[model samples]
Target: MLNRTSLLAAPALAAALLFSAPAAQAQISTPAASPKSTVTQRVGLTDITITYSRPSLKGRQAFGTLVPFGKRWRTGANQTTSIKFSDDVTVEGKKIPAGEYGIYTIPNKTEWLVVFNKSTKQGADVDGFKDDQDVARVSVKPYKLGNKVETFTIGFSDITPATANVDMMWELTGAKFKVTSEVEPKVMAQIDEKVIKNASPSANDLAAAAVYYYDNDKDLKQALAWMQKANATDPKFWNVHTEAKIRLKMKDYKGTVASAEQSKKLALDAKNADYVKMNEDLIVEAKKTGKL
Candidate 1:
């Protein structure tokens, strides 16, 4: 009853039926190794950002062993470690313009050479690296840590209004470089344009200008004048409190005691216990200085 065509088609049809259902769909898997990380910090007037991958020690030897000595490392795992600056900055006394760069470091026993390459899009290898493409380079001393750091890390430490120290650490070794941003000129220009020349600046604007001048050790006379303007506009307790401090700095103890008394009264009415205490202490200091 089986014809030649039917006999051949029978096996083909059976095979098709036996494998008709699609194979199970593939599933996504998690990463098994280094993970990406990002850090952003505002130091002075500049915004600094770093993007890289963190690789763990995993009980393996690092530094001279895995990372190699006297050779450039990507400064992190995976793609090149990238650093971005929103404004021009000086790194380790070398000027670097505002932009993004790929960080590469050559390590040694006593020192490490930090590099900021103009190129950003690159793999961890140095196949296409050119020394002429470097934006800046500086040598930093490496220090040993007492405690072991299991994962590689980069962070900003010892931060000030105009400077920050960028620290890179892995295993028991660490290196640091300082980044400084110019802030005085920027703030001074703003002060001159916004508060000094403005005909009808608000109380808050005047107060802000006064605070900046006072904090930056600028012309205290101008600071006192601005604070006086703010106080004349509102006569608020906080405004008077700042005036008292400025007067103290100017050695006007009598003025300090007078303004501090007003601040203490207003602070009590506002139920601000902290400001009241501060004014009281300032008054005591003013009396001791024979200015009251």
Candidate 2:
């Protein structure tokens, strides 16, 4: 049993509340001004990851103005930027163990000091940190960019089999530091255990070990022997091409020409012109100076 006055008051109250609500309201899903970014790259067998926020210029100067010159910066806006490494790495020849670290930087006109601090979390700033806890510090020269970069960026560049660069760029300036990992010894150990010491190695294993040795400039005689075993029967053109290269390096002109010719014939039968041309080049090189 509802009273008429109560029913009328409910409608009036609802209308008043709807009209009197604040004009400004918080959105549950709004984009951040400085959005978070993540980048990961593998140098050798190590996985390097970076997590940070990207802040845009928005008509203001970036270097020396917004991010002052020669002062330790948090490396990004909002929270501290973090870098993680899966294995021990050498940064600019200074070694740092595998773990997470906060990145701080001292930007300048010619060079920059990149710091890897042990403190990872703080109250949204890098002001409360000390240099005693730093894992590694490196000074890297800065490069000028022709075009402007509105937002801050961190990436891995100049990647090779065992090395890479941690590149940081903002506005018209860029800085980078080299990172190298100890991959050769680990790879060599694995190869020695699996292929060298094994009583019977597969064709694929032998070919792989031989190629690694050839690329690394190990004993050419051993490489040739393994390659010969791998290519003794049912040889692929690519494998034979590698054998030709090894023989050429060893200056076995006759063997080089024979292996290259065989590879050329197999390549022609397989409808691959690239290998055919490669073998022709090797044959020409071997026949040069009347060596054969």
Report lDDT per candidate: 0.91, 0.89
Badly placed stretches (over 4 Å) of model 1 are: 1-27
Candidate 2, residues 1-292: lDDT per residue as tens digits?
8899999899999988787675335447789999999999999989999999999999999988988887888889898899999999999989999999998888888889988988866523446767778889999999998888999999988999899998898888899999998898888897798788998888888888889899989999999988898898559899999999999999888999999999999999999999999999999999993366
Candidate 2, residue 252: CA error in Å?
A: 0.9
Q: Write candidate 1's Cα lDDT for 99-211 as tens digits.
A: 99999999999999999999876554667688888999999999998898899999999999999999999999999999999888888888788898999888988998998
Best by lDDT: 1
Q: Which 10 successive residues of model 1 have the least lDDT summed? A: 19-28
Clashing residue pairs in candidate 1 (N, C-alpha, C atoms within 3 angstroms): none
Which pairs clash in model 2? none
- Backbone clash count, each prediction separately: 0, 0
Q: Cα RMSD for candidate 2? A: 4.0
Q: What TM-score, over all chains together, does every model reach?
A: 0.88, 0.86
